[model samples]
Target chain A: MRELEERIKNDGQVLGEDVLKVDNFLNHQVDPQLMYHMGEEFHRLFQDKKITKILTVESSGIAPAVMAGLIFQVPVVFARKHKSLTLKNDLYTAKVYSFTKKVSNEISISKKFLSSDDHVLIIDDFLANGQAVQGLMEIIDAADATLEGVGIVIEKTFQKGRQLLDENGVEVQSLARIKAFENGQVVFVDEDQD
Target chain B: MRELEERIKNDGQVLGEDVLKVDNFLNHQVDPQLMYHMGEEFHRLFQDKKITKILTVESSGIAPAVMAGLIFQVPVVFARKHKSLTLKNDLYTAKVYSFTKKVSNEISISKKFLSSDDHVLIIDDFLANGQAVQGLMEIIDAADATLEGVGIVIEKTFQKGRQLLDENGVEVQSLARIKAFENGQVVFVDEDQD
Candidate 1:
């Protein structure tokens, strides 16, 4: 977590007050070594949860989710996103509203992949608006699967996402918690307070 | 490679003549251990190329590319796809036509990630039409980067993709090569012939 926090400070780009672009290492251009370490940390945090599957949204989430799946030795399912409103029958689907993009995208997972017997862990690159995580949770619920916990690579604490998860009593762990962005610099929440 | 071929024979679904749906393990629902092994095989194949970076298209290609990045101890850059025709100055972009979808999507990579000094190895989930690989190669050419080779998880030998790459004289290594789909059964090109 410390390494991730440091990497954010060193390489991450701050856009205005609320945006932190980690395209350099976390999203667009990925450092797989860092992803591996984050996966190890997630395993150490949720080793006893009996997680049967790892779920995430596609593209950015695949790197860390797959790495965590490797450590957890469980299958990783990435929900496919579609701009179209056309629906399918054999899939569990949910609508996620992205505040940045100002559009609602439909995310879906095949019904064959998840079931009531599975315990699922949700993983993603960033937890800002919590829309993506909430969507995955809905898919899991539709499958009658148990939600074990949520693992995040980077979290924006100043946003309402963490607060919403806390209100819902969902167990959440993030490798790096960004308190805020001030004058083109990142302010991290102290691990002691976290 | 043998294990990968076996997995395809066991789990891959042949939909119609050319479509091989591998969502059970390769794309939608990923087996990370299998991905790790695929990464190892890629490293074994391209170890002598002196690859400084790994490249792939987003969504489906992220898994194998990131895994190969981990094993190769290099960075992986996934080209972002856009449905719109918007262009940016700081990115190297290419237009890719998806025959199945009947749409032309634009893929772009940040200029900062690739350079003339970089030796790139392109990895992807499937190489059926080779449009995505050709797009990445175009981006690499735009950046003046040297493409060492390509690593494909599955290749369709009956498709024109293999012929195009062969004509271009690009070194390509595929873990599993499908010769044809006979009555919904996958027929792999013999390893000796490959």
Candidate 2:
């Protein structure tokens, strides 16, 4: 977590108050060494949760989720953003609004992949408004699966996402928590607080 | 490669004549163990290429690309399918047609990630018509970066994708090569032929 916090400080770009662009190392262009370390940290945090599967949405979340799956030695399932020909008809579906893209898209997972017997851990890159994480949780709930916990790479604590997930009783762990972004600078939450 | 071919034969689904779905292990619901093995195989194949970065498009391609980056101990850069607020304006863009969705989308990579000094290895899930790979190659060309080669998980030999890349003198390596799909049964190209 300290390494991630430092990487954010060194390489992250804050473009306005709400958008923190980590394309240099976190999202677009990724540092796989740092990524696997984050995965190891996630595995260390949730090793005893009996997680059978790791779940995440498409695009950015796939890297860390798959890496975590490698460490946890579980299958990783990613919900697709669009309905593709390869995706089956019987699916657990939920609608998620992307604040960055300003669009609401339907995210779905095949019913054959998830079941009531599975314990799921949801992972993602950035948790801003919590829309994507909430959507994944809905899919997990629809599958009648157990929601073990959520692992986030970077979280914006100033946003209401943490409160929303807390209200839903979802245990969340994030490597880097941004307390605030002021004057093109990022303020991180105290290490002890996390 | 033998394990990958076996996985396709066992878990892959043949839909009609064109689509071969490996969502059970390759894309949607992934086997991390198998996925990382593929990454190791890729590293073995392209180890001498001096690849500085691994590149792919978003959504499905992120997993394998990131996995390869882990083994290669280099950075992985994925082109965004849509222009989002987090993506910068300075980008190398290319148009690609998707046969699955029957639509063309502009894929863009931030100019900051790639440079002429970098040697890139393109990694992806499927190489059907080679449109996405071509789009990525175009981005690499725009940046004046050196494209070392391409690593594909599955390549439909019946399609013209291989020929297209061949005509362009692009080196390609695919783990599973499908010869045909006859009567909902998948037939793979002889391993010796590859």
Candidate 3:
């Protein structure tokens, strides 16, 4: 977590009041070495949980999820953001509003992949409005599966995402929690959130 | 390669005349163990190329690319299929026509992530028409980087993907190539493709 926090402060670019671009290492272009470390951290956090599967949305989250899955020795089920053509009639669909994109998109997972017996660990690159996390939770709910916990790389603590999940009783852990991005410097929450 | 070949024969489902679905292990719900094995195979194939990075398009391809990147100790840069406000202006974009979805979508990579000095390995889940591969290659070209090679987990040999790549003189290696899909069986090519 210190490594991630350090990387964010050193390499993360603050574009505006809201956008913290860590694309150079976190999302768009991934540092696989750091990625493995992050995966190992997730594995340590969820070491005791019955995490049969790791779930994430496509594009950015898949990398960390794959890394964590490898460390945890569990399968990964990534929800496709792109529209599907071979989809059967049965699906667990949820509409998620991306606060970053400022648009809403429907994310779904096939019913066949998840079920009542499985416990899923949800992962993502960033946690902002918590829409993507909520959508993944919805899919898990629809499948009658247990929501094991949520793992995030970077979290915006100023946002309502953490507060919302806290009120809902979902166990959420973020590697680096941003207190503020004022004056072109990132301030951390300073709490060890393992 | 035998492990991957066995996974295909065991879990892969034939949809119709030509469509083979390996969602049980490859795409929809990925088996991380099998995916790791596939990554090992890809690493074994492209070991001598000195692959600086792994390039892939998003959604289904992200997982395999991440696995491969982890195995090879490189970064993974995925082409974003949907453009967002956060990535409006800083991108090297290309258009790709999805044969399955039957629509053209813009796939873009942040220009900051790729550069001329990089040697990339383009990895994907399936290579059907090879349009997506061409789109990714075009983005790499825009960056003035070179494609070290292309590694696909499964390639439909009956499709035009292999021929087009061979015509372009790009080296390709697919773990399992589907020669035919008939009578609910997914047939493998004569050998592990080189």
TM-score of each: 0.97, 0.94, 0.93
| DockQ of predictions, in order shown | 0.95, 0.84, 0.74
Tell me the lDDT of model 3 at B124. Answer: 92
Query: Residue B112 CA error for candidate 1 (Å)?
Result: 0.9
Question: What TM-score does chain B of candidate 2 reach?
Answer: 0.94
Write down the lDDT of every candidate, Cα atoms only: 0.93, 0.90, 0.86
lDDT of 3 by residue, B1-194 (tens): 77888888888788867778788777778777777888889999999997998998877887778778888999888887853335558789888998887888888888878899999999998989999999999999999999999999889988999999999999999987888876988768874443
Candidate 3: residue pairs that collide: none
Candidate 1 CAPRI classification by DockQ = high
Off by over 4 Å in 3: A82-88, A191-194, B83-89, B191-194
Interface RMSD of 2: 0.8
Quote the lDDT for A118 in model 3.
93
Quality of model 2 by C-alpha lDDT: 0.90
Point out the higher-scoring one by TM-score: 2 or 3. Answer: 2
Please provide, for model 2 over A32-142, each residue's C-alpha lDDT reduced to its tens digit, 9 standing for 90 to 100: 889899999999999889999999988788889999999999999998996334555698888898788888888998899999999999999988899999999988888
lDDT of 1 by residue, B1-194 (tens): 88898898888888987899999998799999999999999999999889999999998899999999999999999999998555588999999999888999999999999999999999998888899999999999999999999999999888788889889989999998888888999888884464
lDDT of 1 by residue, A1-194 (tens): 88998899899999977989999997899999999999999999999899999999988999999999999999999999998556588899999999988999999999999999999999999999899999998998899999999999999998889999889899999998888887899988894474
Ranking by TM-score: 1, 2, 3
